[model samples]
Target: MSKTEKISELKTNKTRKVAFMFNDELWQLFKQTCETNKTKPTWEIEKWILNYLDKNNALD
Candidate 1:
């Protein structure tokens, strides 16, 4: 499949919600990081958590 097709396929999968809590200072830091990286902090953090879980095989 092409990149667009693969992305569309992924988009069709069910997504789960994950909530995070951080102090105001940490939140500001996260916002700055997101702005510098030109991406949503939440999405970046979620991807990081998923990668960590996959690497450790902890999701099972």
Candidate 2:
């Protein structure tokens, strides 16, 4: 499938893109670590957010 098609599918699945600003060095290290662990940065961030919400009883 085409890249555009894949992106469209993601959008249709109710996923939204999020952007963040981070220290360059920290961002690089985090990305590299995730790569080394065979994981995506988004997955890690999602897990962290979910845990934070759950801990604070803020989940919907």
Candidate 3:
């Protein structure tokens, strides 16, 4: 019933972490655009991933 064991038992969801680097100015512009549209950067990245997968016929 320690903290580490409790943490391990709580991890019931499956999700992968996606990461990458971006140019400073371009990243700032992208964040500003998403903010103007009331969207988050993570949501935009997820949409881009889905579109890429569909375009490449990689989705199951």
Candidate 2 Cα outliers beyond 4 Å, as residue runs? 1-13
TM-scores of the models, in the order given: 0.59, 0.70, 0.68
Best by lDDT: 2
Worst 10 residues of 1 by lDDT: 2-11
* TM-score for candidate 3: 0.68
Candidate 1: deviation at residue 25, Å? Answer: 0.6
**Local distance difference test, candidate 3:** 0.72
Give the winner by TM-score: 1 or 3: 3
> Model 2, poorest ten-residue lDDT window?
3-12
How many residue pairs collide in each prediction?
0, 0, 0
In candidate 3, stretches whose alpha carbon ends up further than 4 angstroms from where it belongs are 1-14
Give candidate 2's whole-model lDDT.
Answer: 0.74
What local lDDT does model 2 show for residue 38?
A: 99
lDDT of 1: 0.71
Model 1 stretches with alpha carbons more than 4 Å out: 1-18, 58-60
lDDT, candidate 2, 9-55, per-residue tens: 54357557778999999999999999999999887887686577657
Evaluated at residue 47, the lDDT of candidate 1 is 74
- What does candidate 3's lDDT look like per residue over 1-60, in tens digits? 654453344343337676789999999999999999999998788668557765775553
Q: Which clashing pairs does model 2 show?
A: none
RMSD of each: 5.0, 8.6, 9.9
